[model samples]
Target: MAKYTLTVNGGNKEVEAMEDMPLLWVIRDLLGMKGTKFGCGQALCGACTVHLDGVAIRSCSLPVSSVGEGKITTIEGLSEGCDHPVQKAWVQHNVPQCGYCQSGQIMNAAALLTANPTPTDEEIEQGMAGNLCRCGTYNRIKEAIVTASKSL
Candidate 1:
């Protein structure tokens, strides 16, 4: 096992695990941050998306040790009371269906807004391309993104 110091959800944590252990397992299984989900361990799905130093990343294929010294933010850290504009917009737009992909979708949307506070529809489509909502809420997702962008 290797010792890794990672900042997650604005907290510092020391974790002991195999070097190749996926960061998703480290955060969800070890650190108890379930907001980053497990889907398609091969990283094809964006269900395990998180922010590494403010950049959206697929956590399923990321090794715990590879995240040294970087700040990580899951959906849990997106707001203190889940009052982030995106969350609010998500609720206002009723974006989630089954809700399995909401966390990843939110993370990707958050990253997009962080990069471009006023993204066009095409940009939102490009940014959120990796996230798949099995419920087929793409239009609502884009609408929520636009709503959140304006609110932010």
Candidate 2:
């Protein structure tokens, strides 16, 4: 086991784990930050999405050691009291079914808007492409993203 000090949600967090352990386990298991979910252990599913230096990344496949000095932002850190524009838009649009993947969805949307404050509908879809919502709330997700863009 090795020691890693990760900057998560604006704070420094020290943890111990195997070098090959995924960041998802570090965030969820070791750090006890549960908002970032584990869907497919592979990186294919964005259910474990988190911001690494403000870029959306699949934590499930990212080794803890590779994170180095990057800042990690999980859904819990997305905002205070769920006031993030994207989160507000999500609730305004009622964009969840099973709600299993909304955290990842929200995190992905936040990253998208951060990079492109005003994204067209097509761009929203393109940006949210890899993050899968099994409930197929794609339309509502897109609408929420559009609505969130206006608030950004």
**What is the C-alpha local distance difference test score of candidate 2?**
0.94
| Candidate 2 residue lDDT tens string, 103-142 | 9999999999999999888899899999998999999999
lDDT of 1: 0.93
lDDT of 1 by residue, 1-152 (tens): 98888898899988999999999999999999888999899878799999999999999999988998999999999899999999999999999999998999999999999999999999999999999888999999999999999987
Provide TM-scores for the models.
0.98, 0.98
Cα lDDT of all candidates, in order? 0.93, 0.94
Query: Deviation in angstroms for 91 in model 1?
Result: 0.2
Which candidate number maximizes lDDT? 2
Clash pairs, candidate 1, are: none
Model 2: CA > 4 A from native? none
